[model samples]
Target: MEVPAERVEPKVEAAYRALGERVSLPGFRKGRVPRALLEQRFRGQVREDVIRALIPESYLEALRETHLEPLGDPRVEEVSFAEGEPLRYRAVVDVKPPLAVKDYSGVPVSRKEVTVTDEEVEALLQQLRERAAEYVPMEGWPALKEDLVILDYQGT
Candidate 1:
């Protein structure tokens, strides 16, 4: 993405004018700082600001000109800028690729058979019994705090 000198010079000048307006200098009223002075005092800053402002704009402009639609943020590098010269740069952009329409009419999908054994069924029944159990009134009997069950020992 290279912005020609003709385009960049005006923007740099505009940036200088904008900075001059906001900055205060001794013996100079606000917005009255000269362009040369601004360039001299804030040279690196002005260059940085101008380049920062130009890079994205140029990148977008190039994209539009090339008719390329990008999918993500660009990786910008190899920036080259000089006073009174064109702003040159290289941006690695991730372009949106055209996708093909997929046909699924003939696709085969398989399902695995899962078997439930007797133990599984019993476990499910036990879970249901525990979940559904509720306290009920005993008929013709007094309520007790606890109950015990007696059973014979057996092997599985």
Candidate 2:
């Protein structure tokens, strides 16, 4: 993405102005730093801001222009930036491959008949009987710790 001077110069100027609005220097109130002073004191910061703003914007523009849905974040490289001039850069990125799908209608699925053993059935029945049983009062006997439960069941 090689942004021409016309585009980058304005962004650099805009970054300077935006920085001016937020910075406070000695002997001056906030947002009152002269452009020359800001350029002298924060040139590196201004360039960093310009680069940060330009890269993502240009990357998105490239993606839109190519109509590409890439897979990962762009790795930006090969920058050529100078004051009062254009921004030259390159980006490396990964993209998704075309997917291949096959064998829809003819796919075979296996079926099996479920079988339960007599022992399994009897164990399940015993569990059910214990769950359904309830305590009843004995009319003439004292309730003891050892007692037999008789469940009269008519199971479906």
lDDT of each: 0.85, 0.89
Model 1's number of clashes is 0
Error of 1 at 95 (Å): 2.1
What digit string (tens of lDDT, one per residue) describes model 1 on residues 1-156?
A: 678999899888888888999998998999898878888999889889988888888888888889898888899889889999899988997888887989988999999999999999999998998778775656666556553334479899
Error of 2 at 24 (Å): 1.8
Please give the distance, in angstroms, between residue 36's alpha carbon in candidate 2 and its true position after superposition. 0.8
**Model 2 regions lying over 4 Å from their true place:** 98-156
Model 1: CA > 4 A from native: 101-156
Per-model root-mean-square deviation over C-alphas: 10.9, 11.4
TM-score of each: 0.61, 0.62
Model 2, span 39-148: residue lDDT tens: 99999998999999998998899899988889999888998898877899989898877779986889888899999999999999999988888767676776566566
Please state the error at residue 76 of candidate 1 in Å: 0.8
